[model samples]
Target: MSPPARARPLSKAAFSPTFSKLKTSIYTDSLRPSAPVSSAHFIRTLSWNAPGTLIATGAADRTLRIWNPEKTNVKNSTELRGHTGGVERVAFHPVNETELASCSSDGMVRFWDVRSKAVVGEVKVGGEPFTLAWTPDGSEIVAGRKDNNLIPISRSTLTTITEHHQPVQTNQCVFTWDGSAIFLTNGDGCVKILRYPSFEHFYTLNAHTSSCYALSISPSGGYLAIGGGDALVSLWDTQEWMCVRTLDKIEGPVKSVDFSFDGSYVVGGSDEDNKLHIAHTETGEYVYTIDTIHPAAYVAWHPCRYVLAYSAEAQGLKIRSTMDVQAPLNPSTLFSVRGLLVVITGGGTSIGLAIASALHQNGASKIYLLGRRIATLEKAVETLKSSSSAPHYVDVLINNAGVIGPRNGIELHESESISQLRGAMLKDWSGWESTMAINTQSVFGVSAAFLPLLEAENIRRHWQGSKVTGYGNARHHSASALEKIGTDADDSRLAHIITVASIASYIRRCAAGLVDNASKGAAAHIGNMLSTLLAEWGIRSNVGRPWNENNIGGLILFLVGNGGTYISGTVQVSDGGRLGVFPSMY
Candidate 1:
C-alpha cells in the first residue's frame, strides 16, 4: 500500500452553493433563569395547552414554571410550588386553558389553576409517580408509576377509579385521538395499545430494537410516532397500529418526541447527544437540529405557532424557532384546511367527532355535524362554534358516522363444528343485518346526501382563486408570520367525499401491498394497501389525498387552500398494513 491515499479535496461550488446543497435552517431560542441557584435547576418536563399560548415546565428544582412563549424574551412568568420531590411531568387540561395537571418524583399529582397560581386539586399517587395524562374529555386522569401500574383517577375527585398493570415498565403513555384506547412505550422495545375503560389488549408493536422511551400522536389521530433507545422514531398508522416508517439520524437514545402544530415535522430530543432532531413525518428525512446541550425530558409544540418548547435535564427551557419557518416554501404546510366547509356524518361521537374537532381547531371554514340524534349533533356544533374562529361554509364531508354493530357476535370455539356455525349464523342474523346497515350501507347514503355541498365548496374555491385571489382562498392564503405555510398554490381538489371504512372488507389483494408485525419475519410490504394503506396514506389515485384516516382537517385545509385542486376518484386506505399482517381474513 502506498502509505495513505491522499484524501480528495472538497470541491467548492464555483458560484451558488445554496442551490447546490440543501439549505439547513436551525431555528432555536433558549430561556434560562437569570441566575443559577442550585443543582436542582435541571428541567424535567414541558407542557402546552391546546390553545398554545401558555407553556408549563417541571424541573428537578421541584418548581413548576408557566410562561407565555409568544413573547420575545420569555421570562419565568409564574411559578407553582408544593411538590416535595423533583417535578417530573406536566399536562394541560384538554378543554380548560387555565388548568394544568402535573406529577412528580415526590409521589404526588397536582392540578394547578394558572390564573389563580394555586394547586386546585391534589392527589397522592405515590409509588414514584413519573407521568400524567388526561382523557380527551378532561373528565379523568391517568398516572403511571414505577411499579408497572397505570391508575386512572377522576379529575374532579382526584381519586383512583381503577388501575391497570402493564407487564413491562413504561416510559411514556398517551391516549388515542378519540380516547378509545391508551398507548404505552415499554421496556421491551415495543409500543402497547390497550382499549380504554374496557382495558382490552388492542395490540403490540415492536417499534425499536431497544426500550422505547417516547410516544406521540398526531393532532388529527391519523398517525402515532414512537422513539426509543435505538436512536430511531417509528411512525405508525393509528387505524391499524402498523409501523409506517422508521426515522433515523439521531445521535443517541431518543428521550422525548413531538409533532409540530401542523403535523409536518417531528421533533425528538436525544439524551446522550443532547440535541433535538427534526424530521419530515412523511418521508422520514432529516430536516434540522437544535443543539440543546442537555438531555431533554420532553418537548412541546405551540398549538397555533412555529415556536417549540423543550426542557432538558440541567437546562431550564428552550423555546426554539428558525428563520426558515418564515419562508413561503416550508414543507410542513402542505396539508392544510384553511377555509373549507366540512360536513361530518355521525359527527357527534368517536372518529367522526375527532375529525370534526381537528378541522375546527385548525381553521376549516366551517364544520356541520350530521347524525341521527339531533341533540348530539347540535351539541357538537355548539362546542365547535365556541372553539374555532368563524368561517364561511362547511366544505368537506367526512362520512365517518357508523356503528361497530351488535354488541353480541358469534365466537368460534374449537369444539364447535360446521353445523354449529350455520346455526350460530342464523341466530346472529339480526346482528349481521344491523352491522351491514350502518357500517356498510350507510356509506352510499351519507355520500349522496353531502355530495352537493362538497361540489358547491369546490366551485367556490375555483371562483376565489380565479378572481382577486383574496381571503379564504386556501393556498396563498395570507396569514400572520408564525403560522404554517401553505404549499405550491394550485387547487384541483374539488369537492372531496372522504369515506371511512375498516380493514375487515378487503377480500382480495396483491401480496406486495401489506405489512406485518415483527413476529413472522415482520416483513412490512406496501401492497396495493391490502389493508392499511388505503386508510393510512390517502388514496394516491385520481384525487390527491393524505395518509389513510387522512387527517381530515389537514386535507380539508389543503383542498380549500388551492393545495389539492382537480383531485378525485380514488379509494384511500389507512388500515396500518393490516392485510399484510394477517393475510386475507376471508
Candidate 2:
C-alpha cells in the first residue's frame, strides 16, 4: 500500500502534533468494538429482591436465570433447571434472596435456591400452572392452573393444602393481606373468594362477561384489580365482592395487571397492541402508555424499583424504566339512563305520564311515552320537549289508551248482566288489552330495539369517568369513596331500569272488603323482591307508595338519587305504614 502513503497533518496548535492520527485510530479501535453487541440477554419472568439488587427470571427455554444487573458479565450467575417445560411465572421469597419459586406449563411448581442452582422442592399441580403468587408471609404459594382451580401449596413441604373450584381457566390469583383468604379469576369471567386453609366459597363475583385474564390486589386488600379479555379492567371491592369501577377502554384483552407499591398507580398489559397502560387507582384515568412491539404475556412491578418487566414470545423478556406521564384530566359528569322505552297496556293514565316525567327529571336521557290517544301522546311529547333541556331525547308512542273499565262492581261485571255497567266493563277490558299491547308488549319490543344504543351508552359512561356520587349540588367522587354509594341517579353513573307495576297487583283478593289489607300486603311483597334483584345489578327499584301516601315523589327521587345506590332488587313499598303492620316482614 506504498507504506500507507504518509498522511498529511496540517492541523492547528490545539491538534496535539505529538499524537499521530494513525496511532489515535489504533487506540480508539482497541477501546471500542466496530459493531458492538448488547451484553443483556432476553428475560421471561422477572422478580426483584427486597433491596432490588438481585433479580430472578424464568425463561421459555426451560431454565431459571439469576442476574445481577450491576455486574457487567454476561453470565446468568446461576442457572436452575427442574422444569422440563417453559417456566411461566416466578416469585422470590420475601426474606430470602437466594430462594424463589417458579411455575411451568408442565403442571409443576418448583422451589429453587438461586445461589446453589439447586431444586429445593416441587409440587405437582394437576393442570398447567398459569399463575403463581406467594403469600404475604411467604408461608404458602397459590398457583392458578389451566383448569379453573387454585391450588395452594405449603412453601416448606411443597404439599397441596387446598384447591378451589372456579369453573373457568384460572389465569390469576392473589392472597389477602392477612392471608386469611384468596381471590382468583378464571377465563369464565368469574372472580371467587375462598377462605385460605378451608377453601370455603365466600363470594362469587359475576361481573365480567368474558375471560378475566389478570388480577392484582391492593396492598391493604380493600380493592382488587382485574383485567379481562373483554378489554375492560375492573376495580372490585374485596369486602363487598362487587365491581366498583372499570379502567381504560381497551381494544384488546388485558393479560396482566399490577398495582404500584404506593397503590396510587395501576399498570396493565394488553394483548391487542402489546402495550402497557398505567392508570390512576382512584379515578381509573390513563396515566401513560409504554410502546413495545412484543406481545407481553405478563408484567410485574419491582416492589422497590421503578423498573417493570414483561414476557414476550419472540423477545423472551424485557425490562424498562417507567416514565412519569401526566395524568388525564378529571372526567366529566354526564348522566344517562338506558332502557327508557315503556309500553302502557291499560288506557292512558296521568300516573303513566308522571312516571315517565319523573324518570326524565331524574336523568333518564331517553323516554318512550306510550298511551292510546294520538293527540294525548303528541301533546305529552310537546310538553316534555318544551319543559326539559334534553327534549329531543324523548320519544312517544300511541297504544290502546283508555279508562280502566265501567264503574260497575266486580260481581256485576263478572255476571251476565245486560246493562250499561257490563258494557262499560267490557269496554274497559278492551282498553286494558290495548294497555298490555302498549305497556307490556311494546315495552319489551322497544327495549329490544334500543339495546344496542343502551350498551353503547353504558360503554361510553364507563370511559367518561368514575361512578358519580352525590345529590343535587353535591360534589361527585367515586361511589366507594362516597358516604353512600347507592344505585340512585345522584350517586352512580350506572344505567337504571324502572318497572311501574300497579298498586292493584299487590291488593290480595280485592273481591272481599279487605281491599286495603290485601293491597298493603301485596305491595310490601313486591317491593321487597324487586329491591333484592335490583341490588344484584346495582340498580334500585321503588314501587309506588301506598295509593295515597305523602312524600311518594320524594321517596322516588331519593331512591333514584345518591341515597339509592346501595338499594336494589327490593321493592320499595310506596304504600304507607299499612304494609309495615302486616305479619309478614320482607
Candidate 3:
C-alpha cells in the first residue's frame, strides 16, 4: 500500500504511544497468595460505564470483574461469578453504572446489579453469545451468538424480544447512535445493516476481502469502522454509506475496534502480539502503537476522556492516559466545592452559617437552609444569595441545632441533701428532653430524610443509583469524573452529612453539663452509625467537634468538597488540642 497520509500534530497530544498495564488485585498475582495462580485466563471483552467511572471485564476464567481504575488496592475489584463457561462479552448500561450485562460461552446472557453482586435477569439464547451491546437509550440489549443468532433482550423484562438468525457467522454487533439500526459483522467480510425493532436488512457493505470481525460507530454517528480477518480496518461515512478511509498496518486479523470520544482517532486491536494501533480518523495515518506482551484482543476508549482501555491475552485489563490529562489531586483544585448542591440545618447562624459563607464564596451551585425559625433561615438565604454570583445552590445540613441543659453532674452532686439533689434533677427534665430531640434525634431524622434526594442527585448526574448494602457494593466514582460540573462530566462526589456535635461527646469531665454532654454523645454516635448505614447507599457521614467557628467552616468545606469524597464515618475533632488539655477520655 502507498504511504499513509501525513499525521497531524494534534494526534501526538491526543494519546500517549506507550500503554501501561494497570495493576489490579486480579492482575497482581502476588496479592492472592492462597489461590492458585495461572496465566491462561485471558480477558475476552470489556466495557466502560456511562460515567467512565468503572470498567467491566469478562474473561476465560468464567468470571466478570468490575474495576475502578482510580483505585489500585487489593479490594478495589468485585467479581461476579455465575457464568458456567468462559465469558465472551460484557457491557454496562448506557446510563446506569450499577447495571451490567454479560454473555458467556454457556449459551446464556445474564443481567446484573453490580452493587448487589446479584443476577437481576438472565436468558438462555440456545447458542454461545460471543458479543453484547446495549442500546443508546439503555432500554434493551442485543446479544450475538457464535451460531449466527441475533437476540434482543429487554431491560425491563430480561426475556428475549425476538431472535434473528443471520446468513453468515456473526462475530460482533453494535447499535447505531439513534438506535434506529444495527451494524453486524459476519464471516463474509461484509457489514450487514439491519433496521432495528423489526430486524429487517437495510443494506450491506463489502468492507473487507475476508471475514469481518469488529464494528464501532463514531460518537457523532457520522462514521462507521469495520475490522476484518484481512488485517484491515475500514472507515465509512454513515450518511453516504461510502468508504472513507482504510487502515492496514495490522499484523493479524483485527479483533476489536473503537473510536475515541471526540471522534479524533480510532484504535484497532489485533491478534498479533503488541499490534494495537491507533490512527487519526481524518488523515487515516497511524499515530501510536501500543506494545503488549500478548495479543491485544479487545479495545475500548473511555466514553468521556482520552484514556484507552484494552485487554491483552492473559494480562487482564490495562489503561493508559495522554499527557494532556491533568491530575485530579492538584492542590489548587481539590478543595473547591463548585457546582455542588447543598442543604444545611441550623444554617441561620453560627458555624452553620459560616459554612454557608464558605460554600457561597467557593462557588457552590445551590444552598438551602433549614432551621426551626423560618425568618432566620430566610434571612440567611437572602444574605448568602446576595453575596453569591451563582443564582442556584444546594448544600448539606450542618445539623448544629442544639440546646444546653441543667448543670454538670458534679455540680448537681454538690447538693448534700437528697431532697435538694432531687429538686435540682427535676428542675429542668423538660429541657433535657428537648435537648435530645433536637441534638440527637433530629440529626438522624434529617439525614435519613435526605437519603432519597442524595441518591437522586447521583442519578441526575448520570451516575448509577446508590448501591444497596451487600457483598460487592463499593464506591464506583472514577477520579476524572469527581472533579466538578464541566463540559465533559459532573462532580462525582457522593451525598455527605456533617453533624456539628460538641467536644463534650468524648470528654468524660462532664464540664459541659449532664444532658448537654449526653445529647452530644448521642449525636456523635448517630453520625458514626450513619457512616456505616449510608455507606452502602453512597452517602458519607462524619461528626465534627467544632471548637472554633472558622475551623468548623473549613472542615465543612473539606468534607463536602471533592477532596473529601474518600472520607466517611469518622469523628473529626477540631478542638485545637482542647481534648488533650482536659482530663477526659477522648
Candidate 4:
C-alpha cells in the first residue's frame, strides 16, 4: 500500500486575528430585586442559539436568562426558572433555532423550546450532570458528570441509550464537527478520542499537568483547544493530533475556553478575578485581556460574528464585540450622565436643586430627593421628571442637607458683659445637637444605607466589586488596549457619592457660627474617610462645596459623568474665584 501523506503546516498569517481592539457595548441583564444584590447568581455556562439572534445562560442562581444582544436596555431580557440546583452547562441544538438544552447539578438534562420558554423534554441522567453537548446531526445528546460517567441519549426517544464509565472524572466533552468522533477531557489530564456509536476508545493524548477542565474545537474542524488547571491552553492541529502551540500567561485554572467564529483566535476563562485571556491561534501570542471584576467562568463566541459572550462568577453574562465599530471620544460621553440614578438630600432648593437640575439636563436616569417635607421633595421630582426621559436606579448619592446652628454673630462692643455674650450663645445651644446629627452624622448614615444599591450599580456595569487599595495589579493594565477602545463599553468606573460640604470646613473665617463650621468640617472629613472605607466596596466618595451655585452643579455633573472616574476621595471646590479674593484657607 502507498504511504499516507503528511499534513501541511498551518499558515501563521492566515489565522491572525482580524481585529486587535475590542469593546463591551452591551450591559449584562439585571437579576430581579428579589435576589439579594449582595449575593449574586454566578453564571457558569452559556450558549448561542443557532441563528445567533438570542443567547441562553445558566447561572448558579438556578435560573436561565434569554437575551437579545441588539437591545440597549438590560431590563428587556427574559428569565426562566425551574432548576433546583446550580446550572452547569447550556447548549443550543445545532440545527433547531428554537431548541436548547442544559444540564445541571439537579441531575437532569432538560431540553427547552425557546419560543415558548418551556421545557419540552428531559432526560434524568442522574448524578450531577456538569456538561452537555448536542450531536452535529441533532439526533443525540451526551452529558458528563462529576461522578466519572458519560451518558448518551437518543434525541427522539429522550432517554439514556447507554453510559460509558471512565477511569477518571470527566470535566468537559464535545462531538467533533463531523460527528464521527468524541473528545472528552478527564481529571487525570488527558484528552480521549472515542469512535462514534461503537463506544470504542480511539486515541488518548496527554494534554495537561493538572486536571483538564475545558475543551473546544475550531469552526473549520482543523484545530482543538484544551484548557487545564495549569492555566494554559494547548492548541492542536486536528489532522495529526499534534500539539502546535501552547498559550500560557493566564493566572489561574482555565475553567472555560472557546474559539472565534473564524477560528483565528481562542479565549480562555480563568478562575482568577479579572482574567479573560485571549490569544492568537497561529502564533500563540497574547492578543487581548478582558478585565472582569470576578473570575470569568464561561466564554462563547458568536456563531457567525466575532462577538464574544462570557460570564463572571456570580456576576452574570456580558457580551463584548471585537469588531472595531465603536465611536471615538466625544463631549457628550465625557460630560453626560445619561444613565446614572442620583439621590440628593435637600434637593428641593438652592444649591441642591441646581445640582439636581444640572443632572436632569445632562441625562441622569432618575433623581431621588430625600427630605422631611413631602411637598418639597415631590415638587423637585416633578420638575426634574417633567423635562426628561429616564429610568429609576441609584448610581450616585448626594449629601446636601444642613442647618445653620445658633446664629451667635456678635461684635466686640455689641455685648457689655461676658455674661451677656455667654447667654447670647447659650440661648439657642439646643440647636447644635440637631445640626450635627443632620449634617455630619447623616453623611455617614446615608452613605452606609445606600451601599448595597451602589454596589449593585457597579455589578450592573459588570465591574468587579471591592478593592479600594492602591491600584495593585490593575494599574499595570491601565495603558492596555481597553482604554484605547472608542466605545462607552470600556468604562470600568465605580459607583460614586457626592457630599456637599462648605468652605467653612476649610476657611478659618466662618460664614455662620463655630458650631456650623464644626459640623460642616466634620462632614467634609467623613466624606474623605468614606472614600477609603468604602473603596473596598467599589464605591467612590467626593466632597463638593458650592462657591457658585451654578458652578457646583456643573462640577457635580462632571463628577458623575465619564470624566470623573479618577476623581474619588477628593474635594471639588466651586468658589468661582472667591478663594483668590478671600484670605481664607482653601
lDDT of 3 by residue, 1-586 (tens): 1111111113233334333322212343235555654654667788987667788887777868888877645387898989999988898887677889998889998989999999999999877888887877788999988778888988887788988988889888898866799888989899999999898999999999999999998754667999999888999998899999999888889989998765667998886747678887766877777676777778898776567888755456777753333322346546787767778788888888887888888987777777899888889988897333432322355677777777657657577899887775666676887788998999988887777777766555434454543332223332222223461232446667888888889887666578888898899999999988876666778888877778876787788775675678888888878788887665
Task: TM-score winner between 1 and 4, please give it.
Answer: 1
Count of clashing residue pairs in every prediction? 46, 40, 13, 3
**TM-scores for candidates 1 onward, in order:** 0.55, 0.46, 0.57, 0.52
lDDT of 1 at 167: 84
**lDDT (tens digit, per residue) of candidate 2 on 1-586:** 0001111111122112212121100001112334442322234466766445566776665766776655424353566777878888888876565678899989999888877778889999967886887876687888877766777889878799987766556777777765688777866888877787787888878857898877888643567898888888899876677777888656588877886543545777775666777666666666556666756656776553335666544444555532222211112222222333333222234655665556556564455555556787777777666232332221212122222222334654365656754454444343444443433444445444443443343333221222222111011122223222222222233334444444444544332222223333443344445445433222334544424323444555554443343344445556555445544334
Whole-model lDDT, model 4? 0.75
Cα distance off (Å), candidate 3, residue 501: 1.1
Winner on TM-score (2 vs 4): 4
How would the candidate models be sorted by lDDT, starting from the highest?
A: 4, 3, 1, 2
Across residues 1-586, which tens digit of lDDT does each residue of candidate 4 receive?
1111111111223223333355565445654633544333667778887657788887666878788877746676667667788888888887776788888889989888877878899989989998787778788989988888889989899999999888888888888865789999888899999998776999998999998999998755667999999988899988898999998877789988998654657898886848777777766777667777777777898765567888754446677754323323456776788767788898888888899899888877678888888888778878887333433336899999988777765532266889887776665788989999999999989888888788777656545455423221121111112222332443545688989998778776545776787899899999999988876566889999887677887789788887787678889877666666766665
Scored against the true structure, residue 24 in model 3 reaches a CA lDDT of: 19
What C-alpha lDDT, on a 0 to 100 scale, does residue 569 get in candidate 1? 41
Ranking by TM-score: 3, 1, 4, 2
Tens-digit lDDT string for candidate 1 (1-586): 0111111111112111221232222212234445554646666678877666688877776878787665534443787888888888899987777799999888888989998898898888768888787887788889999999888989877798887888889988899755789988999999888899877998989889999999998754557889899888889987676888888777788888887654556788775776777766656766666666766656776655445677655445667643332323434445666665667678887667767788777767667777899888878888788334443433565656555443223232321789875554354446555555665456556655554444444334332122211111112111111122231222224445555544434524322111111101111111112123222212211222223434654554444344443343434444556656665642
